[model samples]
Target: MGSNEYFTEAVVLDKEPSGEFDSIAHLYTQELGRVSASVTSARKILSKLNSHLEPLNLVQVRLVEKNRFHVADVLKTGALDRQHLDALKLIKSITPEAQPDPELWHLIKTNLNEKDILSILGFDSQFAACLGCGLKKDLRFSINDLSYFCVACYDRLL
Candidate 1:
């Protein structure tokens, strides 16, 4: 797809530093599933592209499906996070994989207050751990990240 054609709303998750100017961004969208795409001339000075690629903000992206996801370009962007910038930051921080997380992410997005969402995602609210010992919880950070521990296991501290 060209500049005019692309997916629906997407929020930038994570991007890797590439060379000196380009970066690859991971996005989660309402329409498409999880995707990561690269954008060049993003890190350039005086470029508005910097403003468009922010966490929690909704952006219109144009992309093409290759072996890995590719972002051809971003069309128009809008601010979507009335909840707060801090909430988005917290989600991005604890979420190691960014896109593939469904449960915790959903919990965050559902919360009305960004601070509350951040609380759940941060170290303070006991969100960083599974409720159990090593009781057969999924260790994989990117896929299926839900597991809970019983009170006995919690009391045992094992």
Candidate 2:
């Protein structure tokens, strides 16, 4: 049989330096859910793989399935164009290399495939509101700590 290749959206979870030249990518594929692959090194100046290797980028890569890992050939990239490339560059400049937000990664990959960026952002924002008798929009909650109400509402919850 011929090699199988996939055309799907993927989010970078983690990437590490493999062997002497190659690097392994822990990718979350829309079609396969989760997969691990070793990408060829883009060491030379003319390498297109250099730009495709960054984490947090929304990319579509063509890969041939192999015994050990899904071998990949990066077809194209820059989902966000040159005008929007500024946005990605800004985001990368602030975020530490090699780390990704697990929750955001999932949210981004799913929403991106569905083409519903606003919906996901809105849902995550409004879901923070607490279930209380008289709550306003200003009500603050820590999405991390699960803190949803003031001291008074905590009493009612008891």
Candidate 1 per-residue lDDT over residues 9-74, each given as its tens digit = 667665666667776676765455456676664345314554666666667876666555566666
Error of 2 at 8 (Å): 1.5
**Quick one: best lDDT, which candidate?**
1
Record all residue pairs in model 2 with backbone atoms less than 3 Å apart, i.e. clashing.
none
Candidate 2's residue-wise lDDT over 1-158, tens digit each? 56667766665545677878777766555565556677774556214663575655556766567554554565434443233333233222233332334544465534332212223334333445554644645554333333455446655556
TM-score, structure 2 vs. true: 0.46
Q: What TM-score does each of the candidates earn?
A: 0.50, 0.46
Runs with alpha carbons beyond 4 Å of true place in candidate 2: 41-47, 75-106, 110-158
The global Cα lDDT (0 to 1) of model 2 is: 0.50
